[model samples]
Target: MNDSARAKPLPTPETQHYWDGAAAGELRLQRCQACSKAYFPPRPFCPACGSRGVRVFAASGKATLYSYIINHRAAPGFTAPYAIAVVQLAEGPRLMTNIIDCPQTPEALVLDMALEVAFQKLDDTITLPVFRPAGA
Candidate 1:
């Protein structure tokens, strides 16, 4: 498996904006106008209030590692070991992403570690938002 196969993204009508933002080297999140709550996995309406007044905005690309699990088994196109993490963005949304550019070991994946976004372009249309140790 190649990077292209591993880089496939799930895009829905509601998430097209997010994928577009990633393509442009930007991180975007959806905010509800009614409740002013920022959320991830962009949806058609606000999850908190069920309002359709959701807007997309760019994020600061700063986050902290909330939790993670190290996978030693290699999946198709994935390396033998990698860290799949849930990162808490500075904007208050938690996103499920992969942590990159560091040793994928329990000793290196410290909880609450600060991280920054690093875009990995898989192909012409897809880009992945991976995180690395902040300032590394």
Candidate 2:
């Protein structure tokens, strides 16, 4: 799908830093200072420990394919035959994202494949962090 056709994310105050980091070509995630666990879908408090002492940091941007499904039906802003994927980050957080730079096929989208972060700019304000096969 074209970049303009993709739905833009509405950044909330709590999630503004995440969007900012994406625009700056960084994959930022939250880490709990209290429990030393990294997480996503940004929040002020740690889900692991319920501590507000969470800190935002740039992630390693390395991940492994955890799970995915190839959606062949066309939808708003998304073309058919795209893989909706869950990738486990090196820091231990798994997030839902799209896989790009490769064929969206069952054979191509292997389980446990190594991936790295790639930014797709939807506009001036939003740059999404998608993933692609590592070294591809």
Question: Best by lDDT, which number?
Answer: 2
Please provide, for model 2 over 21-56, each residue's C-alpha lDDT reduced to its tens digit, 9 standing for 90 to 100. Answer: 999999999999999988888999999889999999
What is the TM-score of each predicted model, taking all chains together?
0.93, 0.95
**Considering summed lDDT, which 10 consecutive residues are worst modelled in model 2?**
1-10
Candidate 1's displacement at residue 75, Å, is 0.4
Instruction: Give the Å error, residue 119, model 2.
Output: 0.2
lDDT of 1 by residue, 1-136 (tens): 4564564877888789898999999999989999999998889899999999989999999999999888888787788778889999999999988888889899999999999998988778888888999999
Q: Which candidate number has the best TM-score? A: 2
Pull out the clashing pairs in model 2. none
